[model samples]
Target chain A: MTSLVADIGGTNTRVALAEGPGLMPDTVRRYRNADHADLTDVLTDYLREAGSPEIAGACAALAGPVRHGRGRLTNLDWTIEEAAIARVSGTPRVKLLNDLAAQGHALDQLAPEALVPVLDGPAQPGATRLVIGIGTGFNAAAVHALPGGLMVGEAEAGQVSLPVADAEALSLAQFLAGADGFAAVEEALSGRGLGRLYDWASAGAGRPGATDARAVMAALDTDPEALRAAETFVRLLGTVAGDLALQHLPYGGIYLIGGMARAVTPHAGPMGFAGTFRRKGRFSALMAEFRVSTVIDDFAALTGCASFLARTE
Target chain B: MTSLVADIGGTNTRVALAEGPGLMPDTVRRYRNADHADLTDVLTDYLREAGSPEIAGACAALAGPVRHGRGRLTNLDWTIEEAAIARVSGTPRVKLLNDLAAQGHALDQLAPEALVPVLDGPAQPGATRLVIGIGTGFNAAAVHALPGGLMVGEAEAGQVSLPVADAEALSLAQFLAGADGFAAVEEALSGRGLGRLYDWASAGAGRPGATDARAVMAALDTDPEALRAAETFVRLLGTVAGDLALQHLPYGGIYLIGGMARAVTPHAGPMGFAGTFRRKGRFSALMAEFRVSTVIDDFAALTGCASFLARTE
Candidate 1:
């Protein structure tokens, strides 16, 4: 059976026809969300282009929370509801899931080569796996292997209070706390978080600049401040990842996804990422027992949506 | 059919005969762990005293990690293997689970009166519930409600780095970081953690003394340092609970269980516990949606083991 699957992000929406639990990369089409009025229009146009192939159902992975079968894109001015999507796409069933949950559903489908191991540990088949998305934002979900099916519980870990251990990092934490008096993990771990870290480093060296995350990463080779900022970002990622590994105990593995993962992956190994992740006080050894990996594919959410649809059917 | 269930703790072993999901309080028995050579000896003694009922199966919750159907008591010189336990108890089957996992299984079995709500939120029938045990040590598990059954993923939350937001808490985090260079949540959140907090508070006041957690709690009315320490304890508890809630997104509820839960429950409301728990920067409202509660029963672990036994069969 063929089904329509879409990953609705703020900037772009990727639509594809899913055959069984897998998706063909060539069939996936990307459309700028700004080009469409809403998800219904987007689906209508995509179906027209695909010659209106009959789909059994449609599922979307939204870049925002899906509440009561409805989801509003976080960065775009469009809301997609299950009934509306089903009506426009001419599908019998429609499902909306948090993007992180979609990525969780794609965990098993990800080819072995698509994953890069940050920490090596024994993988038990029936144990839980965690999917963490670190892009414009940070969120996570634990995928539990169950008798009936996989259950993915979404997490808002980005907003959780950041753990600061180093005295140097304490200054950054205080600065990030600002008026709210709370330094969330996202403040130091997201793309904007990278820029903030660079600003802090530059300010500390009496050379503050308004460089963004991309410019900061580009300057890593020649600029000491940029290098320090990137290092700090990776270390904080380690802290957050370690904390989450403990919180979820995903012995199956912790899989990192999204754009920021690509940015951090290069420096993660050299910047004391795994070391910080394993330094869990007395249970440091136990922390080492959990594996860490990154999902390199950009279409994981689409894959997840397709998988979810197939599993439900 | 009656089944044997036991909760093995650091200092004592609790044994009971469970007819179903609930246990008869009159049938509960406690034994000092030090009095037995091993778990088999302890079980033999417990079964003999229980009039040797015709047990179908047995399940034991151990105060340690269970691996490969075996567990070694964290604080006692006893190793309990599934086969050894089955042999000793003469049960058809035996299971071993981390004590926290057992407590998680007991979440639904707990009577309404056994749970004290600290934060009120709508409880959906099949939402995830989190159980955190803060006793001589700390651990947690997220109980996912599955169509077929419940799935509990045990967490080593205690070993996760402590989240510090304020200057005062940062100082304590640094002090507690010790040689490990990390301040694990358990270092400041467990039973002994209370004493450490009190000690830090006393030393800061230049009136250091050998005061235990019980003594500090007893002097809360008369001692300024004790009051501050207790307040910090509650705030930190709130911080940990809030962080775990974000990590797990347990909209069902966050449940506090164990000895320290009782000690800290009184100060929770007055010491800005929920306030801190809900102070999640942008996701504060989402945090508020999660109900916080403390498990009041002392025998929840035993109940959990019996419940697990029944369900697995």
Candidate 2:
């Protein structure tokens, strides 16, 4: 019998079967959430396709709040419950974790090849590490390195107020405040945040047009507005990263997870990301000593789910 | 045998002998650090006054950075070493903690009466709590409530860039930036912070006077400048507290410790502290659910030291 681990997002789901901490290479499968009515339906389909093998235990990671043994998809009108998963998947034991929390567990299992270095500072063994996810949404977690094991402190950090510093940023803040009455960190850091920045810049340049984050990023080289928007996005990411580094003092390093990480990493080198991060007055020296990396492995969450189940067992 | 607990600050030191978590009320003694040469001298004097009873273990909380069983007092020309304390106090075991870390442990030990509630929300039993100390120096810690126990995460949060809003705050930020090249949270939140706010406001009103925090506070009723300074201090405290609450997501509550908490709490009610804290746009409703309290007990660090020693043992 093998443990089944799954990461369920709003539009897609990744399922895998493994016996231990690492995900089984060939046993991983992806499914469209819209093709199924609920998580149980998708789990059942995946099991049947895999010849309905006996399951020892199961762990599921979702991009939403997990409380009372249940989680509701942030974008989809669906809820996954531990009892329902256990009954459908034929497992007596079931575990659920926040997507970012699962990503936090993946820190130890990530291979050197799976990471792209942003800052190569001296990292201490068994030091606390911080993980930040800037995807369609924003969230963070601190993985405490203890003598016994790692303890992850999950957070809804995107809900925090936005930290603005310049005239352009102040204008964006005013625009956000005008629309929502308060500007949250997520308003300037998420996928939609990129789009917002693009629109704001385009409007300021007197060439206003509606566009998504991808379209804006694609036009970065050709469109001055897009380039400006991208720069602002990179700078804002740096600012938030600096704030989190201070709040957590994660001397071990900071790991940026999720899709948007790739976009943020290229701009976070010696005097780009790390520069804005370390410009915090007297503590700049201490902040300079923190390492930063982007998790390039797409299957990290699956490996993390497997690790979580094994640890719980 | 009783464990000896001592909280050593730059100017004062409180020593006590306790058997467990709670302090031995009458056994507590306060001493002037200036009267002694170093921590060893203070420890030796305290041991002698306490009749030199058989010592079990000792935990000392000093206002400094503790690493490798050594600590340096931030405001004093002294360093405390575990070996030195163990040698002088005749104790086989000695533990040293950062003053704020010691306070983090006191969260669980504080009595209901010792907490002056600023926000009364439904706190989760095993949720995370944040402790912020705004004394001579500023720092904070996040206490994660785990299934097994509480894990305290230490922070040098004062060094992070300050978060500012409003014209007055923007003006203050500009002033701080001109002076220090960067605006850190501690520049506007500590004891000297009150004085800085008063000075800035007075300068703006063309009634400039160089006054310390104590003098400004004493002139609050009759002096308009002092009143404005006091108001700004309270509002800044709230803003910082709110930012911290978001950063840590301390749904369990936010506890204000040290000498400055009492002064800040009186102005933290509906339209004061709590109001500013719950003004975070869309997350305002959620922020309203966080409990805020001022720790009134002066012996909290002593009690915390006792708790830490007991837990480790």
Clashing pairs in 1: none
Q: Name the regions of candidate 2 deviating beyond 4 angstroms.
A: A178-180, B178-180
Over the stretch B166-274, how does candidate 2's per-residue lDDT look in tens digits? Answer: 4456678766663335678887788888788888888999986778878877887799988887887787777778878877878778889877677767756632776
lDDT of 1 at B44: 88
DockQ score of candidate 2?
0.58
Best by DockQ: 1
> What docking class should model 1 receive?
medium
The TM-score values for the models, in the order shown, are: 0.97, 0.97
Error of 1 at B150 (Å): 1.4
State in Å the error of residue A260, model 1. 0.8
Which lDDT tens digits does candidate 2 get at residues A22-133? 7896998999988889989989988999999999999999998898899988899988999999998988899888999899888888899999998788777788899999
Weakest lDDT window of 10 consecutive positions for candidate 2 chain A:
A173-182
